[model samples]
Every structure is written in C-alpha cells, then in structure tokens.
Target: METTLRKSDEHESISDGNELRHGSVVIAAITSCTNTSNPSVMIGAALLARNALEKGLKVKSFVKTSFAPGSRVVIDYLKDAGLMDYLEELGFHLVGYGCTTCIGNSGPLKNEFINDIQDKDLVVASVLSGNRNFEGRINPHTRVNYLASPPLVVAFALAGTVSINMEKEPLGTDLEGNLVFLRDVWPNSKEITKLIDKFVSTKLYTKEYSEIFKGWDLWNELKPPKEDVYQWEENSTYIREPPFFKDFPMEKPPTTDIKGARVIALLGGSVTTDHISPAGTIPLDMPAGRYLISKGIDIDNFNSFGSRRGNDEVMMRGTFGNIRIKNLLTNREGGWTSYHPTKEIMPIYDAAIKYIDSNTPLIVIAGNDYGMGSSRDWAAKGTQLLGIKAVIAESFERIHRSNLVGMGVLPLQFKEGESATSLGLTGEETFDIYGIREIEPLSELDVTARGINEEELKFKVIARLDTPIDIEYYQNGGILHTVLRNMIKK
Candidate 1:
C-alpha cells in the first residue's frame, strides 16, 4: 500500500512511541472537482452536514474544514436547494471555485493548531476526496491521509479520528447522550435524487463559465511590457530575466568534461519534483522566505513557491527546499548542505552561492525514481542555477530527465544494480565526470570521486541524451538558449 493511505476502520492511530494518542483530523475538506462536479455528491454532503449539525455532532475545533466547488453552478444549486446554509452552519462553507486539497491549496490551518502539533508531534491527518495524496502534499504537518467521498469527509471530521470505525464507532454524543454514527447521519438516496433533479439548471454552468476566457476585469485591464526583449532588472523580486542566454552564440557549444564537482545533495528513492523544487507554502526561515522578507515583503504576503516560478532568484533559492526533503550531504534534514571542503552548514541556496562565487561546480547523487512528481520545470532550471553540472541517479523520470537536458544539465544513469549506496558514496566526496570533450548521445562517461579520507573511487554511467537533438540542446546550454541565439541572429 502507498504510505499515504490509512484504513480509518482498522488501523490504530497511535504510534508505539509509548503514549495513547488519538488520530487528529487537522484538515477535513469537501473541496475538489472529484466530488463537487457531481450534483448528487455535493447535495449529499450538505444533507449529511445538516443532519450531523442538527444532532449536535461536533468536530475538533482545530480541524481546518472547507468546501470548494468546481464552478459557480455548485453554489447556485446548493442555494436553490436551500442546503448551502446547512453546510456552512457546520463550517463546510464555500472557500473557492477551484481545486484545493489535492494541490496543497488546503490553505493554512489555525496557528494554535500548528503550534500544538509542532510542540507535541501529534500524528495528525486529513480526510479529503482529493485525487493525490503524496506524503507532504497535504500540508506538511498532516502525516496520514484518507481519501473519502464528500460526505465521508464530513463524517471523519465529526468522528475526529482516523483510528475509529465509521460503521461501528460513535462520532459524538448528542444532548440526550445518544450515540451518533456515520450511518445515522448519512443522507438517503431518495433525498439526494430529488434535490439533484430540482436544483440543477443548465444555465448555472453556462452563465458562470462563459466569461472565463475574457478573464476577470482586473486582469483584462493589466498591461504588458512594451519591449519584445525583456528588460532585465536586477532589483525585481518577483521576476527577472534569466542569464542562461546572456552572451549566447548562434553556433553550438563544446562538449566539456566536469571535474572536481561537489555533491550538493545526496537523496534517496522516490525523490519527487516536490522534493527537488516545492511549490507549497514557504517557511519564513527558508532562504526564499528570507529573501522575500529582506525585500520588505510581509510574511503573510510572501505567497507560495508556485506563485513565483517566473522568478529565477526565488525558484533557485527554493531548489531542494521542501521541508520534508532529506539531504544526506550534511546528515541533517531539509535543504541543508555543507559548503564543499569548508564543511559550513547552511541553506542549499547559500551553499550554492558560495560555491558559484568560488567556481566550484555542483552535482547531485540520488537513488531510484528521481524527479517523479508534478513535472515542474523549475526542478531543472533551479538545479542548473545551483551550479549542478549533472545529476547521476540510479533511475530517472522521463519528463524531468528531458527538462534537465533542456536546461543544459547532463543526466546520467547508473548501470543496473549499481548506485551511490552500491559504490559507498558518502556525499562528501569531490566528483569528476570524464569523456565529455567529444561526448555523443547515449554515450558512456567515466566517473571518479575523492573522499575526505583521500580515497578515490571509479564508476561508469550512461549519458541520458537519447537523441542528437537532446545533445544539441545540452551543448547550447539548454533549449531556451538555443532559441534565443537563433532569434538574435535573425
């Protein structure tokens, strides 16, 4: 089973850490197209919420509950059915007209709850009908997640613990001390059918979505920069022209060997793009957050990593910055890397800056299934900006491997059954990649590393440029650079 799932009916919510603990549902959201698009499900959820609230079913006050519909038609249907108030009364109010939980847009939980979890290390959870449930994708604080239907989300919030069986457990006690189970509150099929038939109007969807292309009035009024070429600004915080095409040439670049490259991070298997370049809420202490703060931006307005993808400075700072990332280089958790031979502990961005200033090239060594999720472009762009000349991994995902090549970073794969662990890499060694002076697509490269103990190790990796076009993209320092150079010549 995937690590993300927990059978609310069977598993014990408490860990063996020697304490009795209830599984806390910190987030309970009926907020995804998965359910909201269906008239039957949305009305059913509201009806269930209505029943629970009337019976005095109470959820933990700390649970960050929400309801986001896919379109305005959902709100219109609920309102026409007079069931919108029923949901809001129980705190499942409409929050947005888009996807939420699955995308890590469940928003922020209460400060009190966040502080409590951090202080106590509570094994928290979220019950959402969202499609994706990668480890940290659902708020880094919530560890266990259960994918349920819209009404089940409400049921779990009332039950307040994933450890309980909805069929067998009492959600809460009523005024007369009556037990309230999920079955007692579940809406009957006839009621849902009647509400769907009565309230769903074709105009609701057509009217709400018609102007989507023209966009909002504010966006329509927004102006664009006048110049064909972007005006590079040194002080702009949100975005600035990248330096990849600076002094670029129309002709192809030389294939070059990389020597004395330092390992920026040593990672383990299933290292998703989220781990490489996260797009969630940025912590105030991370390098990207500090940079935003230094620009006098308030913490609340700092936005998210996804909102700042156009900004190379911020994205570069956010590379390998996921709070859950486990980098083996410094032996500490979360984006910390030792600055080369100096052994100074600092943020990955800071270490990269120091290395760039001193002309020390960087690379990463990883276990299997590297660059697996989100297919984010920044994962490659940021890696290049961090001075990573190449990435040597036991395996690679298709898109990210291509993105790395498109960003002028070489992608290398270890022979089967060979990896950093198999070769005993400590991540503190100086690496050398040879045979690049006349490199070809799908070629083999020799690798050597010198550790702190002055021991040298040698290995071989297959160049991952699968085609002549990929090699061209890499040699010209990425696809964008190649495009720009051609444009300038014309």
Candidate 2:
C-alpha cells in the first residue's frame, strides 16, 4: 500500500528508507504540548509576534506561520492580551484545536509554496516550541525540523530560515540584503512580564476550563456501563481492558533458563517515542486502517492516532509508525517487519503479532538517548500493549524511562563503549536475562544473542530500574493500573 501525503507532490513520501527533502519550509508552526501547557510561554510567543509586527517584521512570502496552542486557555489569554490580530497579520492563523503541527497534523501546505519548495529544492525547517522533531511528523516537505521555545518559534517565523541561531545571528538580509540581527527585535524579560501581567490571568483557567470539564459532544454520546468495572468488549478494538487488569501472577517471571527468543526489531540511535509510537495520519493498509474500516470509517475519515489513544486496536497497530520508520534489519525502508527465521519482510505490527503468537518475548535495541520528548503516557502505553518486554539503549530520556517502568517494560542501558551495532545485533537474534526481578540500578543482566543461523553474540546490559517507586510501578503493571487498584482497595 503506497502512502501519499495529501498536501502536494512537492516532496516524495518516503515509503521506506530515509527520503529527505530540499524545500524552503512553508509551514512554520509553533505548537506543542510543552509550551501550550504553560500560559506564560504562549503569552510570550504572542507578545513577541506582536512586537515584531510593530517593528515592521514580516514573515517570508513562502512561509506560513501558525500557532496551535495545546490548551484552550492559551488562546483565551492571547485574545485577552490583544495580540491575536498582530499574530494573524503575521500569517499566524489558528488552524485546529488540538496537537496540530506537533503530531504532524499540519494540514495542507499551499499549492504555490509547495511548488516553490520542490522547484528550488529548499531545505525547509519547522521551528516548533514543542518537543519531538522526528523527520516526517511535521510536514513531508519539511526536510529538517528543530525544537525550540515558543518565543524562538516566533523569531524563526519572522526570520524564515534555520541557517543561523536567532539568538546571536542575523535572521536575513534587509532591503539591501544587509544582515538583520535577532537582537534588533528581541523582547526583554521585563517587557514579557508586563504583557503577562496585563493579559494572562488565573481567572482564564476558571473561565476557559470550566466549560471544558462539562464534556464534549463526543463524550456525552458514549454509552457508559452500569457497573463500576467495565465488561470486556471482545470485538471492539477501541478500548479493550488489558490482560494485566487481572491479578498479578502469584509467582515471579522466570529470570533465567529462558528458551530461544528472536529479536523483534533492530533500531538505531536517538529513536524517540515518536519512532516507537508515532501519532500521525493512519494509512489505509495498516492494521489500524482495517480496524477503522470495520467500524465504517473510511480512509479519508480516519483522523490521527493521538485522537484514538483510548482505542487499543488502533494505537497498538499504529504503534511504531504509519508509513515512515527506517528499519535496518530487513534493509527494507519504512515500517516493514523482518521475521526472525525467515528474515522476511512484513508489516511491523503483523510481525509483532507473529512473535506474540510464537510466545517470543520482544526487545528493542537502540543507541544513545532513546525515548526523548513529551510527557505523553501513550508513548509507553502503546509499546507495552505491543508486547515489547524490554528496551536496551545507551541512554534513556527521563519521562519515557519512567513511563516504560510504569508500563512494566524493563529498560536497560548499554554499558559505555557498547552499542547495539557494536554488539552485532540483527533482528534474528534471541536474548535472555538472568535474575531480572532482583535487578538493581546499573546491575548487569547477562544477555545472549543467537541469530537464526550459526552466529551468536553475548553482552551484559545495565538495568535502569532507577528507584523503589519505579520498581513498584513496574510491579503494578502501569501507573493507571496501580492508581485504579489502590482506588478499588480504598
């Protein structure tokens, strides 16, 4: 199934391998859960944009600047600050309500700008205040995207390029093409404080969120069960109660003498949660597509994975990626799964299913700084649902490591100087850990990797089971499960 970005034919949609683009980035959106969650940051962005416009700063003709705030109160405060018009004048339009550019819901790039980007081979970048700048999430045309503060996003939009650091460097040329430095219009903390005090009010939270708690039209329509505990719905793929909902096993899991288990996927360095559970547009051919079709929703009607987070079927199927993962094992680009014995190519989700049925425990191997970005619990939840027993990386992001522990997935760190590649791991390798339940931070886990053929490798991975709280969370399956169980007991 070929996945084409509905926007334009400017950049080719990557089916497998790295397909980067050279385009003057047309969409410069400042959106993300991080900054939008903070009222002051969003207000800061709005004020900067307003001040920029007053100083006769204009966004590049090819650029489209938009602000998609995470919370509704952000917009209310922006309005209260009277900076909405200034933002709009600068082409910063309000597109949708939730997680827009951050999750790659950048909508469509204008046809003219898309054409110019392709023709010129522009190396366009999206400067967002949110975390997670994984290659293809923003827009297909955007070749390189950088994460920044909300104020920096505004500065980038005014300057319209990623060539220089706006803090010290000049944005672009003046009328004579002379350099225009960022300091020319940079707002001081004192100025930002005045705006914050004038516009952003604590009252807005009570005003804006009061209605949000009233529930949306969708929530009102959902039929609730009469019982406190939800009866498991077998066929419904949306929200099935997980297997961990049952009582914990009386006995601990076998720590050693585990039989052969093949590698599920061979990952690379800096593989963030976005690579693990990308919340982008769902393709028509994925397992998620089939599930949605069964529910009578056509491919076009299919929105995003983030919107369907409660649905285990959609999320678990769309876990790794939609059509944009660069899998190294099969040497096939873009989200294909490689079978162990056969060393064959299949869809990633389907491959996981095969391993699950065979009772093969799954593990993800990656380089340094794995699972960085966002406090999104789904990043951990989906992987756990996908049956990934463990993740071995050189380093771990703070939130995601905690999240992995919460979901009962063992997180291991590679010893310094040792990497997944250094260990010569392919997707066909089988692994085992001895004395896992008794594992402590930096405790070595004996690991043995044997390929489908005669090749075998061995190494020791460090357990990143940081604290007693983390161990408790893992024991309880996940934070949600732990909280629910405690509530029930009370």
lDDT, candidate 2, equals: 0.71
Residues 446-475 of candidate 2 have per-residue lDDT tens digits of 888777675767788888888877766666
The best candidate in terms of TM-score: 1
lDDT of each: 0.83, 0.71
Candidate 2 Cα misplacement greater than 4 A, ranges:
1-23, 32-62, 70-83, 96-98, 110-123, 148-160, 164-238, 246-257, 322-325, 435-443, 452-455, 465-490
For model 1 the local lDDT of residue 433 reads: 95
- How far residue 283's Cα lies from its native spot in candidate 2, in Å, is 3.2
Candidate 1 residue runs with Cα over 4 Å from true position: 1-22, 33-35, 214-235, 486-490
lDDT of model 1 at residue 176? 88
| Distance from true location, Cα of 57 in model 2, Å | 7.4
Candidate 1, 367: how far from true, in Å? 0.7
Candidate 1 overall Cα lDDT vs. reference? 0.83
Instruction: Compute each candidate's TM-score over C-alphas.
Output: 0.90, 0.73
